[model samples]
Target: MPLPLYLLALAVFAMGTSEFMLAGLLPDIASDFGVTVGTAGVLTSAFAIGMIVGAPLVAALARDWPMRPTLLAFVVVFAVAHAAGALTTSFPILFATRVVAALANAGFLAVALTAAAGLVSPGNKGRALAVLLSGTTVATIAGVPGGAVLGTALGWRATFWAVAVLCLPAALGILKGIPAGRGGDEATGKPALRAELAQLARPRLILVMLLGALVNAATFGSLTFLAPVVTDTAGLDELWISVVLVLFGAGSFVGVTAAGRLSDRSSGPVIAVGGPLLLIGWPALAVLAHEPVALFILVFVQGALSFALGSTLITRVLYQAAGAPTMAGSYATAALNVGAAAGPVVGAATLGTEAGVLGPLWASGLLVAVALLIALPLHAVITASRNTEVQR
Candidate 1:
């Protein structure tokens, strides 16, 4: 990997920490603001909402700007939001800060993925994204848990302050390390927004987008509810919850690392293998819920495989949308936020019934199965496209 890949990793680390810290700090934030933990949880949802909306919106608006400045500007915006979050005492003000922070968070990542892809040779783009996204995986492994512990010890405000502190070095690294002329400004061709939109209107791109949505819904739909269900229904302690969460995070780290290598070689097998694995694992994860040891193993495996699907899928989208790869990247990133935002809502509604904790996981499994059905068509589309390209 290049030095720029490493520098972008730092920015990803900072952004990932800033974006995900709230999930572990919800209780502390609620206590600090005299609100319910439920309300504090909305902060996570708020951030996801901002990402879903801000990604395409910002990409459309700033498609013409020089890439480095735009990426750096978003990082600055994110840093300021964290600082503001640390300082605010009122709920409304803090919530506002979170929304602003999330917009910056979303935009920064969308731009970074595009920028990172631009930095590398064409054949190595998948590795580049995986490396940049490794920060997100690492954040899940270290940052969130550490932030939770820090929130318990130093207060939630202090955690945000810590994240804000890291952003300074990230900005400096980008400024000094990343080469010029590799940003959106130079890469962006004539205004192809309408043309790209027309292209996406084709059945193939729509299938890709739909597959992105279904895959996201399948995994996050269950994951968002995992902690609550495992603890509340299974009568597991917080220690076990932390352990399970760590296991999931660890599995994800391994999966993300492997995804780059796998996609670099054969993206089709990754998707074909991953989708059905989730179909199997989700059901098994729910069935083994009563067996703690077995469930732990299943959760780890499921987390690892579930995440690998989307990253693998992204390479296919990039290949298909060769003329406007950044738009494909933008859509994939936005799908992430959209899935996260939808997960809790879907899980909460499903869990409201008598089906209880297992209900959501089962529902998620069904969604994955549906995604598998979608992936079949996607695989055909990719195969046909490849064959066509070869013949030409």
Candidate 2:
């Protein structure tokens, strides 16, 4: 990988840390603001909303801009949003800042992926993209854990301050390092983002994107409120909760990397394995939440299997789409943001039930099963279309 890839990864690392840190601090924010934890979770929901809205909007608006200026603009947005988040004492202000930060996230990732792909020789594009996205994977493994510890010790605000500080270097790194006019489409007279939107008109493509949304909803719907669930069910302190959650992040990193490889080899088998494994693991996690050791084991497996489906699903979408790969990418990303938005809302609602800690997990498993059912026919579709090209 090029040095640019590492530089982009550092930027993504800061962004990922900003995004996931909220989960660990939801309780703290709630307490400080004198709001319910469920209410404080709106911060995450706001971020997802921003991603869903901002991804295409920014993509469309910036279609004509050279990638360097566009990405640097988004990086600045991220830094400023984090700074605002760090300074705000009011819940509404913090929430708004989170939303703005997430909007930056949407644009940053779209540009980053495009840039990463462009950074390398045509044959090595996939590798570049993978290396760039690994920053997110590393963030999951390291950033979230670090944020949780920071939030617990210095207070939640302090964690956001740390995130803001990280953003400064990330912004500068992006501005200085991204090759001028070398990122995104410098040829074909700049593909209009509106052209990409047309790809959603394909039914199979749309189905695959929706599938990504549903799958993520299944995982994060239960996961968004996992801290409280662990606290109450496992009788663990905040510190222990953070540690176990890190185990979950560890599982996710393993799952994402392994899934990417598995998809390259066989999509059908990967999804088949992922579906049942997630179905079994999620519900088991719910049952095991009462036992800390058991819950840790369950979370590890849950993280691993749940995220393992990502690359497989992305491959399926792109394969089915065939001719319109860029549109397929946009759809996949949009679906992901939609899932992120829906997860917390669903989790909050589920937690209100009498089943308490176990409710969201059961609900999440049902969502996964539904996703599997949707995916079952995808194999036949792929066979009929013969569209299984390697998707970036």
Candidate 3:
């Protein structure tokens, strides 16, 4: 892989840390801002909303700009937003900072993925994406827990400051390492917005986007309520919660690594196999949630399957939208965030009923099943079409 790709990963690590660390700081933010925990939690929603809205908007607007400059500008804005967040005590101001930071984050990721895809040959796109996504998995394992510890010891403001400082190295790396105007579709002229929009409007691309959304909804819906599930269903102590989460993160790392290699051979097989694994794993989790040993094993497997599927699904989208790689990358980001935002709502609603912890697992499994049903036929159609073309 290119050095710039790793630099892009570093930038992604910073954004991922900022995206997830808020969960650990929510309590502190509530206390400091004199608001309810639920009110402080709105900051997360604000961030996701920004991602869903900002990704395509920014990608569309900046499609013709040089990749390095666009990425650097977004990172600088992200750092500034974090710095502002660190200084703000007012709830509203802090909330606005989260939204702005998320917009920058979304824009950066869209460009980074597009650039990463362009850095390598067609056969290596999946692996390149895997390298880029490893940053997020690593963040879940280290950065999020570290931020929680930092918040507990130094306070939430200190954590924000730490994230702000973290962006400097990434910004500098992007500025110095990434080649200018290399990955963009348009080098000397503006991107054809009508053509990009037309590509995005394809039914196959829409199906892939739906697949992305459903898969994320399946994984995140249960994951959003993992703490409650671990405690309520498995009868585990609170301390064990961290252990389970760490195992999940480890699984994600392993899965994405495997996906990088396997998806290079073909995204179709990976998606076909991994999607069913998720469908199987979720229901097994639901059934095994009461059995501590079984539940722990299942959670790790589920995490791996979820992330592996993510890489493959994105590869599939790239394949379908070969003409609009950057816009397609933005669409994938937005779809995942949409699912991320919705999953929690579904989980929360389910928690209120008789089903309790198991509801999310079941809901997630059903969504995955729907996705698999859609994906298998779509893959078949694409394969058949390709075969027909080859024979001609």
Give the per-residue lDDT digits (tens) of candidate 2, residues 213-250. Answer: 88787776776788887788888888876787688788
Candidates 2 and 3 compared: the better one by TM-score is: 2
For residues 107-145, what per-residue lDDT tens digits would candidate 3 score against the true structure? 998877777877887668778989999998887677766
Which candidate do you rate higher for lDDT, 1 or 2? 2
Q: How large is the C-alpha RMSD of every model relative to the true structure?
A: 2.9, 2.7, 3.2
In terms of TM-score, the best-performing candidate is 2
- Candidate 2 collision pairs: none
Q: lDDT of each structure?
A: 0.72, 0.73, 0.77
Q: List the residue pairs that clash in candidate 1.
A: 67-184
Candidate number with greatest lDDT: 3
TM-score of each: 0.88, 0.91, 0.88
Write one digit per residue (lDDT tens) for candidate 1, span 1-392. 88878888988888877665665566567778898655665676677788888877787777766667877898899889889988888899887887898888877777777777777777776788789878887876777667767776788888998898889999998898866555554464643787655556556655666666667666666765565555766677644555666677677778878888877567778887887887899888877887788878987898688768777766555555555545655766776777666655566566657877677688888877877776786686753443452232
Q: Higher-TM-score candidate among 1 and 2? A: 2
Order of the predicted models by lDDT, top scorer first: 3, 2, 1
lDDT at 380 for candidate 1?
A: 62
